[model samples]
Target: MTLVARIRALPADLDDLAGAAAAEGFGMLGVLAREWVAGTQRFAMPEEALFAARDGAGVLLGIGGVTRDPWAPALRMRRFYVRPPARGRGIGRALVAAALDHARGAGAAMVRLRAPAAAARFWEGCGFRPIDDPTATHGLEWPGRG
Candidate 1:
């Protein structure tokens, strides 16, 4: 399936995607949903926040997005999800690639994200190494793995 990403500026079609992502093995899905709602509201009223994802046949197959960062030249990939029906097909991996491309265009120097322990091995296959920092969490680096 084709993967794409768009701005979270409208948030008109995210509630469903959030629910689907929550069903995955990711533990931070709850927090991600809460933040997405808040960010969606903010994005609607403001112009700073951004969200992007991959849509397949009018359904959210994958999700990856970022908010405006004033602190540094980096984008925190707040959430990444692949629907159950869309899993095991490398959709998650494609979505991550799309998200990283978006972040780079937003003038971000680095992109950070969290992956569930269950998916850690998968991310490793994506070339992400665990950092020494406790707060660093989980993420896969690009062009290093695969």
Candidate 2:
């Protein structure tokens, strides 16, 4: 089935988004669960946005978000999770594209994400390069930035 993506606003979206993240082992440590709860609360702010991918039937297939970086003049991509059954179908790519578009519209100088090792290649494929840091997050400078 074809998947469509759009900005998400309902609290129910958070439940499904968090559940997808949890199913991907994010709940094992509980940090992501807490972040999902806290992050969604801030989504209405001018600096943040949440998105959901849904099938033609309107069943959610994936979710993600972007927010202004508190520590840098950049946008931070967060909570990107695609259901296992929906992986390999470009949902993640679509989500990242939407987030980057939002960042550019917000005048961000760059975009950053602390992706897990398992997702390193995926983020790289999305045009992010490893940042020189102990934690090894990925970053992408806004296009045309010298």
lDDT of every model, 2 decimals: 0.56, 0.74
The predictions' CA RMSDs to the true structure, in order, are 5.1, 3.1
> Per-residue alpha-carbon lDDT of model 2 for 41-139, expressed as tens digits?
445657578777888887788777787666677778877888788899999899999888877777777888888889999999999999985533999
Q: For this target, which candidate reaches the highest TM-score against the unseen true structure?
A: 2
Ten-residue stretch with the least lDDT total in model 1:
41-50
Question: lDDT for model 1, on a 0 to 1 scale?
Answer: 0.56
Which stretches of candidate 2 lie above 4 Å from their native place? Answer: 1-5, 11-17, 28-41, 134-136, 143-146
TM-score of 1: 0.66
User: Against the true structure, whose lDDT is highest?
Assistant: 2
Q: Report the poorest 10 consecutive residues by lDDT, candidate 2.
A: 27-36
Which pairs of residues clash in candidate 1, taking residues 3 or more apart in a chain or in different chains?
4-53, 5-53, 8-51
Q: Please give the distance, in angstroms, between residue 120's alpha carbon in candidate 2 and its true position after superposition.
A: 0.4
